[model samples]
Target: MEVLVKDFPIDFVVTWVDGQDEAWLKKYNQYSQQDVLDVRNARFRDYGIFKYWFRAVEKYAPWVNHIYLVTDDQVPKWLNCNNPKITVIDHKQIVPHEYLPIFNSNAIELNIYKIDGLAEHFVYFNDDMFLNRKVKPIDFFSKRGLPRDTAGLNAIQPRYDFDYIHVNNMKIINTKFNKKDVMKKQFFKFLNIKNLELNIYTILLFFWPKFTRFFDLHYPYSIRKSTMKRVISENQNEYIQTMKDRFRSRHDITIWLVRYYALVTGNFSVRSPRVGKIYDLLTTFGEAKRDLTNGKHKMIVLNDDANISETEFDSIVKDLKNLFEKKLPIKTEFEKED
Candidate 1:
């Protein structure tokens, strides 16, 4: 279903980091304590996958107006700064001075909408996220200008845990709304709370069988810049808390809050997700290879969990390069000349 969204002019934003940069490393190690080094902070690994990501976008999402590469004053040597459609944004351009030398993606995401001259409609992509198939504008947004959301019941029962950031998200939601009212509204169905009646339910079915999971998918997020701004303006306290935590603290809220806020405010439309196969490099290389050969998914995530060894990691990178060479062999205009 093609929506006449040419006038909307959707843009793309990607956050990338090079962990090996000496200056970046100095600042990271300076502020990072031993306990927060590995998991809590952004784990930088060079997969050399950005080229393929550009190729994928050029091949599949040609309608994208501009590609904003958000980085901490780092740029790929092979990128073409002359490209009219690509903009490399340094952290200082959008992030405040005090938050300078930031390493956390969660913190960076909060300020993405603040980028000057950003399009009202934009897609946020992690460096690892890619568009594997041709998708129309309606796939992300409706003709009415509402973001299409794909969500699932939480895989695990929802509970509060100081170590888990997602649990912290749930805590904020529960605390903001009355327990019985949240349960009665059917937590999953509380997208719009304008006329929610105060009621009590002995069993909170939404949280019991499974809570609504908003952050599970690793896909390009369809975001509205104005909606994000409004959410931050309305929820100053929560937004401040989210921005204060430089790393992935348990008390910090993830970008999922923006999506949730949009939903609850009737600014988005929920759509059944057309999710493709997911392959974790730490465990499922064989299956990933088979699926890649078969072209089984419209999107694929090559996640680099810190559990793998140096040799295994190198092997995965080799396999990924081979796959991309065979699949997306064309060099994009965004690449520098040889």
Candidate 2:
């Protein structure tokens, strides 16, 4: 099955932060008001890998129309800001003033659609996520402009206390659109439990056994700007409340909400990549390195986890730098010549 092709241009949006910047760190500390351990563990590791990220995109996904590098008043000194294809966006420009100095990624992500002149069809990427293979527009979207569904529901147990965010996301859909309720009434009558008090995860396990956490993909997310706008418009109060969260909270819904909304609305066509195509560097460094060395996968995510030892973390960074340099040694037009 193929989507009808159009002349639409696809843009790439990346959220990044330079934690080592003294000004940014001071601002974060002032707002965080937390101890060193809490602040340090807040997923703020700087492996100095943005250059490789750009290199990967330039090499494998050269068709990308524009690259929006979102940050908090900090730009990589080596980046070519003068490049017409690259734009540096400060958080203050998109996020509301009240949410200023925000350190939470969810807050920044929720407002990415507000970016001026962003394409209606865009791919959102984290600084740690990279394209590992040559790809075209079809890999991200169909010819009809619908995003390819690279995710499915899973029945894995929660790994963090904050996993309730996933539940909250489902509950929002259930309460607002009643999509889940409709599914329960039509397909899940076998359980025969009145007023099912179980959480969304348990309910999904019982009925749609394939429903998994949407976030495990850890790859670039193909998004429709208008869909996100409509979701926020319909759920204005909830959206505002979510944006107001200064830090990640159990009540806050994950940014994957847009993708979930797309799935439930049948706006996306499912396209599952082969197993082992996506790797999380922190936990699967060995496999990730092997995959990169062999050029086996289309995408890989280098998640920064503070729980790992400094030595191990440094080793991973060094190895990743070496691998990326080996694969993409030449700098693209996006970088300034040294």
Candidate 3:
């Protein structure tokens, strides 16, 4: 008898920009001619964002190999790992969109949209999400092997736009818009190609102050390279045709339309959050930190509770080390390619 091994591989990509920098904030205020500025608040947000980003990496690091940091700023020394497999891309080198505002996260997606050809399996994560602990991938999706996550069945948040572009009158891909040769080369042919439909991608069109927290069917956590290239090629000009407009609502609509494509094709999935689960998990870590020992895995702290003693935390961490070592056998060290 022969043994079969199925390797479910994934890459990691993160969105990062230098909007929180003091120098950039100063220049921004001067250009807008504003005396007092709330840009300082953006800086604090970045710190919170990056702290949890580190947590996500630690949790998912076991299954992921290549990590790409999409940014316009100078890569931080800490992010510059000695490991050769980890790659960082500067936005200027990847996709050169100058007119897009630096603060807008949607514009940065174009930079990622350009790199869709690089990785086959990848996860796209927001900097704002807090990932405090490691989780098994199997637990995130449904066991039924269905195309979509249960997160979609829940009532759509009021802040989310359910009908952004109105996918009613989409047309066929005509000769003027279709290029078979380039599409073939970019691996766009793999997807279920269809005529123009309403843009229904992820949470793109849902603007804040009116819409947010869209129960997107598109894999908010992951995307295959083929999907990214296909949508961008099909809707590039339709969404981002204008370089003059800074408003993100239109561009977001275009992106959300792509998410709809994934939903229909069964290429996307979502992990629904459980009630009280967040609080329970956070409390577990707090108690475990005080009860564990040292010589354990490196735990990156994200919370700002000053009263928590580091010495007690180290003890609890030791217990977690033992728990993982005894229960989880898979080693997380990166393997080199021959």
lDDT of 1 by residue, 44-145 (tens): 877887888999889888888899999988999889989999999999999888866666677788889998889998889888776677777776777877
Candidate 2 worst ten-residue window by lDDT: 190-199
TM-score of 3: 0.54
Candidate 2's displacement at residue 56, Å, is 1.0
Return whichever of 1 and 3 wins on TM-score: 1
In terms of lDDT, the poorest run of 10 residues in model 1 is: 194-203
Q: How close is candidate 2 to the true structure, as a TM-score?
A: 0.86
| Cα lDDT of model 2 by residue, 1-338, tens digit | 54322478899999988887899878887867533223464377688778988988888888888999999999999999999999999999999998777776776888999999899999999888878878778888988888865434444367775677777777776665554554454343212232233324345554552344443456788899999998778777777776777766666766688987886666765555442255555687888888788777777776666567888878887998898899889988989988
TM-score of 1: 0.85
